[model samples]
Target: MPVPATGRLQWTDVPTPLRARLEDALDAPVTDTNTPAGGFGHQLAAALTLRGGRRVFVKAAPDADPLTAANVHEAAVLQALPPGAPAPSLLGVHRASRWTAVVIAHLDGPHPDLSPASTDAEQTWALLDKLTSSPAPAPYRAAVSATPSTAASLHGWAELAADPPADLPAAARDRLQQLAELETAWPALACGDRIVHGDLRADNMVRDHHHGVTFVDWAHATTGPACIDAASLAPQLVLAGHTPEDVADLLRDHPATATSPETTTAFLTALTGHWHRNARKPAPPGAPGLRAYQHRAAAAGLALLSHRLS
Candidate 1:
């Protein structure tokens, strides 16, 4: 959650030509629209209510915006999702003039809160369990150009060991040497064959009476160990008030993380470095609270890693 708050485009911001095109794709006139907010950064997302009373979700962004590529990729990924995957269906995409808009089945649900025992938590666990059961589809396996990975960038402890940040947590600074060595094994430990969501957190998930559980935003989908996404969710749950141990106890039965103790430790260790670095830098545009959130996430990760390391 950013502090200045994510600034969203209005439903009116959809160019007249684009809106008309979306109307044609849906075979109905757009009567009204509502903006939906969840992610840390803003993209143009809206629930369009058609004149015929059908509702669909659409996301649009200009080529100039970084999210346009992701929007297009998400549409393609959703279209090819495996059977029974808990996600929205792509209806169609309207691409013109370096602007792109993707329309999909509207999913109604509240974002998950990682609170222990919360219904959101229960639903999200189920969603992860279901998703992890499937591998990345053919398109993902045959991707022509790999998206630049943040995995390589998560090794901040190496830099911190070389030049410790003034705000570095005392616990981390005390064990900088051990952290430096632990991080070296991270990239190697991360190797796996299962498709990973890469980014798994409350904002990327939703649950409703109808759909049961749904995960949105497939931009970070990748071929990795099944354990990666579930393990990634661990720190977020801790940040949401679950103790690290509690999360571990809960995830014990998950096939993904069920046998990957060292892998989980390495991933959390790298994330500790990831957030530790980002939290100390200038906040990115349109995301004022991101740095603070990263710091908190780093702390949660450190708590988890400490237990494993001990």
Candidate 2:
């Protein structure tokens, strides 16, 4: 299935003052703007062609928006990445008139399709191998900790089991108590020394022809088990039309996901529960498509978990 597009702010929708500041930061006049599709969608994300034909990607948010802090964090993460990391280079960060924007050198490519047998999957997995083997940079390790963050964000099965929702599937509801217990295992299982792109779905990656796969959106980056990022690829593979059994087998065979069987099942359960709970909430402002996307992802995740547990 195609990733949903979270409706975003257009270039024309930006205030004139902020636009001028952005252009000044680029040191050029913007000649064209193209908004990319399929992200969390609470900011201004565009591919810009400048006066000298330089192309760059930019994401801007109001100073008051949560995305503003995310962009700031992402800028810091990008700056700290080692030269060989498969991510974009941060060009500059600009802020003015209650808005913040980060500029990045653009990589040309489409988001990878992770269906079984696709070359995109091969390239993406190769990229993950490189990413997971490298230790987090010193500066990044000092700033962000993955354990507490994962513990805080990856809770849902326990909460859901406490008060099961009306829409909860029979597969999960039947095994709710078991799942609630299992979901608690990821924080320990995810503990490691490698850099983890906490969110590693297709939409968060671009398959550059020359670069293999280039990761984007670093707000969730942290140091943890390489398998944390590697395991994230399973549900996305299911979403791309692979069977749950196949995805499970692939994860087992992948070097990065060398954890025990219990660890893999626990992480998948926690991830499914996270999306299952979030998918029921009201859509955030400017991201009407997010809930639907989450709902689909939750279903895909649940399917994989069901197979694993079975």
Candidate 3:
């Protein structure tokens, strides 16, 4: 994943009143804070060291910020995760001085290396298995409909085909109509009730040496086909230096992707279209590197989709 261009806010940058309120809510005094790099947004994500030597992960954003809602949603999803789910436990959600914060158990580890020959890939599969093994909780099923939430974003191929962009990649231009058709197949094929980490990627997972892989970032969690999470990993695997064909073969044999090959093809095509179209737009308000990252990811997705199409 590309390092976010806009640097994250330091803990000290958080308003004093808000920080005080956060500490009060946690019932602990903050002694120190550490902010890590490499995320997609410009949110305040830090690990706080409490007075009693306890550590917790906190992510906060202004009420007006888009991420504020996401933080709130994440807190709810984490709270609703069933027992034994490979995810962090939600500690609390604090809102003060027009800022929103979601705190969770601190997970100490680095993002998994998804390159070929790495055990991290297998660990990710294991996590996916455990995650989808059970039905989505009642709260999530009532609050989120996975297919409709993402269908609009994934329909970009149809729009691009109608009025192709000048900077559209050569490979996509040659098969624009075919891709447009394939992109429409996901809605029908993605019907299921399993909870999926809708945005599964290397950066969204942390590999704890002792505990294996732990999934993070539940903001995009949704109820969909068992394969959604596994399909989301294909482009990332390609980005990690595996050939598109190899990623396809690996996913084909995985239990999560037990659906027809067409399902994976359509999902990847729609996903590629989303990135390709979005990458050409202006950068988002707080994420300068987002479009550039999308451009690179779109290339990877296109390569993966092309192989599947052939």
Candidate 4:
């Protein structure tokens, strides 16, 4: 198994019989396997060479757990997409007692290494337009509805403010308090019933030579306000060198990006505050990236708050 630097379990050689089954199911021989960079998800893709020197990328999630439902929902989301949508096509799904796997048509594109100059922001807006405009299919909606809401999320702002983490810096702590105030004031923000990517960081996007943009990692797909997806991207956008002003401008210009500036600001602030609180704690076994994520989240929160206050 390729152990991740964070000590996460990663891809390893598949048992011979399982590998043969996968090859047969994919209708191609796996030639070269390469570990792609991404989160803690148990997924891997390989380049396959077919008869005429043609190549395709084959991705599999053999270790999908209860999260398999999310993958299944993603397949349904892909199935419901309109023509020319920038995401990959769902190829196949195989399920067994202990695991589930999904195969997708290969997308050949550069990982959208987001930069101030990169077209990621523009492309992401276009993709959001497509996703929010279309209604989520039944299965996807059901899957989202079935998932349990986190207690922190359901408790709303007052509770969050009253219980701010003690370890955060004073500045970050103050910002979190402000976030609670804003969330309380703007408690009635509209949440649309549309299919949201739910996690729209640059890492999940690719810019192919043929396909201008393609999104992956659909495990977070949900039927919620597109604002949540936008909020999810806010931290990553900051990490990618976009200024808070840039992000705010995008949100203001794109109606589907967020419900309102205050709502977006509150969401980003709360998200970062949560991360900062968690990161101050001792690192969990096998989760070194948590600290890095915390720092990034804090930076994102502060940047957004600074812009909003200014």
**lDDT to native, each model:** 0.75, 0.80, 0.80, 0.62
Candidate 2 lDDT, tens digit per residue, 1-310?
A: 1122447777776678978988887789999999877687658889999998989999887888777877887888888877788899999988777888899889889888787768887777777788877677787776564224552258688888989999899998999999888888666776667877778889898877788778998878777777777778888988999888888888887777765567667777888889998898877666777788889999989898888788
Model 2: number of backbone collisions = 0
- For model 2 the local lDDT of residue 291 reads 86
lDDT for residue 146 in candidate 4, whole number 0-100: 58
Encode model 4's per-residue lDDT on 49-150: one tens digit a residue: 555555554444445344456676677666655566667888877654445556667667668866788776777777777777666667656656655323
| lDDT for residue 206 in candidate 3, whole number 0-100 | 82
Local error of candidate 1 at residue 291 (angstroms): 1.8
lDDT for 186 in candidate 4 is: 39
**Candidate 1 off by > 4 Å:** 1-6, 137-140, 143-148, 251-253
Highest lDDT against the true fold, candidate: 3
Whole-model lDDT, candidate 3? Answer: 0.80
Q: Write the per-residue lDDT of candidate 1 for residues 145-197, one digit (tens) a residue.
A: 25645553468889889999887878898898988887888887765556566
Ranking by lDDT: 3, 2, 1, 4
**C-alpha TM-scores of all predictions:** 0.90, 0.91, 0.91, 0.80
TM-score of structure candidate 3: 0.91
* Model 3: residue 193 alpha-carbon error in angstroms: 0.4
| Candidate 2 residue pairs in clash (backbone atoms < 3 Å) | none
Clashing pairs in 1: 3-289
Better model by TM-score: candidate 2 vs candidate 4:
2
Please say which candidate is ahead in lDDT: 1 or 2. 2
